[model samples]
Target: MSGGVDSAVAAARAVEAGHDVVGVHLALNRMPGTLRTGSRGCCTIEDSNDAWRACDRLGIPFYVWDFSERFKADVVDDFVAEYSAGRTPNPCMRCNERIKFAALLEKALALGFDAVCTGHYAKVLRAADGSPELHRAADWAKDQSYVLGVLTAEQLEHCLFPLADTPSKAEVRAEAEHRGLSVAKKPDSHDICFISDGDTRGWLAEQIEMEPGDIVDETGAKVGEHAGANAFTVGQRKGLRLGRPAPDGKPRFVLEIRPKDATVVVGPEKLLAVEWIRGIRLSWAGLPPAGAEAGEEFACEAQVRAHGDPVPARARVEPAGGDPASGGTAGGDPADGGPAEGEPADGVPGPVLHLTLDAPLRGVAPGQTVVLYQGTRVLGQATIDAATALDRVG
Candidate 1:
């Protein structure tokens, strides 16, 4: 139940709908926080207690599943690996993809449960043919469909979201209060749950073997020196600590990270404009839209971040291994632009998607997920392998 108001209210609604419900709280850490600090982090011991109390009040059984080992391997380690390779990874997306839906749902179905219900603010509508379609929730401000975009058609078949049509998070809190749920007033968690202190750079420093590196401008001239290259991300501007100001007297932002030689590339903000993107490890929410299986370009909206606005774009999926002739762009690093390291050899089946934005998106980096949508329905998602700047295109 996540030990939160939304999940508590969702469980109540499920019970009210006359379905047998069990509250499952995932124990995703070997050493969980003992208390929550405002909204800084989640999955604390206190959260588990709150979940248990809510289940008790609802007269349902509650169980705590220890998936800490799996979480570390899939989400935490993946985050470290992505950063070490100079890519920004979304751990929440990984958690939702690997742990919550895949592992938890698998165990739930094995126990003879019809479905796994949650408080995610997304809808699963049945098409005319009775197939499930994933759509954004009525509460657009609180919609979590972006993170849940990794679900497959089969997974959506055994899933339920009770808070789909709720107008706002306020209504969910109100319902929780009405039900006397203890977590009705609990603050929502933010930042990465594993890093309780929220010092991402500091946490990563301990996990990755970072070294001092040169901070260079677009022309490959050193402007300054950084304590560690791993701590920087594209679009970051505050901590460059440049030894001199730009010749144009304008601010400089990180445009790329080259961990191979520990070089951080900085330039004027305009250099961050991304017009093209390539992604791998593609997965669809449900059935592929018409023509997607045939690698046809189609109009859709692409969303990079969880809460970022969707952008108008055209996207097409390529058969496994991608098109060899166009694997790299004019200004792409082999680590990002060309075939991903260890990718399947040519002619071997694998998944990849290419996208062109109607308008340039700023600071898009490799390792982020790009979710494709048509109107409010989620079409599919892929982990971005590369992003090409608008002006750098050949």
Candidate 2:
């Protein structure tokens, strides 16, 4: 449980369903704060107490598992590394992909547990052949399937989400109130949990060495300077402190960041339009779609952010043949050099998912994840290695 109303209610429902349920609150921080600072972050000591109270009320055992070291290695360090490489990453997705599902589920199964249930607002549907399929929840506004898109077929079988059928978050809160749960009115957590103060740039600055660098425009003319190129993000219009404005008197946004030489690129907003995306480190929530294993194109929807709109798109898997050491684009996964899992060892990249969007996605960046879907079912996800503008698509 997250010490939130959703998880509290989810545990109540699981007990009502007559299943033996145990409430587990992962202690992900090495030194968590004693109190929550409103809704800015999570996994604090206050959250753990709230989770314990909820489990007590439900007449079930509750335990706090210390996965702080693993969390730091997988999520915190990865976030810093991605930023240092001039790429934006979603730490929540990484947490779900590595810690919650992989580590926690593995431990649960080893202890003879049936499954690991959570408060995520997603559904697991069983096919006619009894295979599990991940789908969007009933409440679109609260759907979390995008972050859970990294789950493999084997992981989905050991997962359960009790909030799948809830109409809204309000309903979950109301149910918590009905159950007399103390966290019924607890505010939902936001921002990065590790950065409790909510100052991401400041937190990152402390972790990554910052060097002042030149900020340039599309014409290769220097417009201003930044204290640290790593602190800026794509589509960011604030904090540029550009001394010279555009000739047309229009504001420019961050178009790119070159960490190699600490160069920050700024341009008109139109330059942020992206029409193509090439992703690596591919992972599927279930079975590979038909023809996807054979390198044939298929129709699907792609979502870059957790709550971003799903765009109509076509995707295909194709061999990216080259020396793995020198083949990958900037922001590609470090493991991109090795042969993909479950693929033949031919000394090639095996495959990379290429997506063509029907409409332009603004400010799409490398190191971001793209979740694929067909209707409400999640097909898979990939970490973006590069994005191409319409004019550059040939």
Candidate 3:
């Protein structure tokens, strides 16, 4: 639990279901925040105390597990590195994959718990064949299944989401208030939980060594100066501080960040449109069905980032040969213009698949997840490796 109201209510619901629930709060980091006197992020000392208090009221046991080292290495470091490479990273997805589901789940199993439960606003269902499937929550506005598409089959097997079937967030809060839980009225934490001030650029600047660089227009003309290339992300429009005016007086957007050259590229809004995304690493909850062969292509809905609508696209399963797919139409055929080659002839699909969007998508960023879906069922997800405009290359 992240010591949030949702998880608190989830723990209570688990007890109401008559299961032997042991509340586990992961101490992922001890980073200081400006909230309470000694509080860090959501998992702060005060928040954990609130969790323990809820457990006490529910007559269940609670424990705090320290996984700070793993969290820093996996989630924090990865976030910094991804930004340094001129990509927008989603730390929450990384945390859920490496910490919550992998590390915490393993620990819970070692402790002999029947299954691990969380307050995520998504549901776990059984397919017609009784296979596990991840679905959007009843509360559509609060659905979080997109980031959770990274769960492996093993993780899904031993996981429980009590709030998935629960009512809306308001109703959950009402239930907590009815139970007199302390966190019932706690404000929902926004932004990255670890970055309390919501200044990721400031936090990143302090953590990594940076050099002043040029902010250039699409024509390579220097427009302004920035603290670092990693400070910006694709689609960023504000705070550019470009002193020049566009010929058309239209707004400008960040088209690209070239860390290698220490340059931030700005251009008209139209140039920001990207027609294709490539080199995605897909991870399914379970292996695909039998007879599904590597290099086999299928049509599915692909979501390039969280809170974005899923788009129709074709996914071609590729072998893990380290030669990532390159250049494809945003929503058209793969850049190779045919079946993906070099995939193993064996029926076993590799851990990665290459997806080509039918049309360019705006604000496609590297390091964000591109999750695939079959209707409401989550197929898998991959870290976005690259995005390109339809008319640029391929």
Cα lDDT, all candidates: 0.86, 0.86, 0.77
Higher-scoring candidate on TM-score, 1 or 2? 1
Q: Give the TM-score of candidate 2.
A: 0.93
Model 1 agreement with the true structure over 60-88: per-residue lDDT tens digits: 99999999999999999999988998889
For 1-394, candidate 2 gives per-residue lDDT tens digits of: 9899988888888899999999999999888765779998899999999999999999999999999999999999999988998989999999999999999999999999989899999999987788899999999999999999999999999988999999999988888888899998899999999998999999999999998999999889999998998998888998899999999999999998899899999999999999888777888888878888666789999999989999999997755543344454222332432222232211224467778899989999888999999999999998886776846543
* RMSD to truth, every model: 3.2, 4.7, 4.5
Q: Considering summed lDDT, which 10 consecutive residues are worst modelled in model 3?
A: 338-347
Model 3: per-residue Cα lDDT at residue 201:
86
Query: What is residue 70's positional error in candidate 1, in angstroms?
Result: 0.5
| The candidate that achieves the highest TM-score relative to the unseen native structure | 1
Q: 2 or 3, which is superior by lDDT?
A: 2
Q: Please, what is the TM-score per model? A: 0.93, 0.93, 0.89
Which pairs clash in model 2?
A: none
**Residue 163 in candidate 1 has what lDDT?**
96
- In model 1, residue pairs whose N, Cα or C atoms come closer than 3 Å (at least 3 residues apart or on different chains), thus clashing, are 320-350
Per-residue accuracy of model 3 over 138-202 as CA lDDT, tens digit each? 88778889989889877888888988866689999999999888888887766787787778889
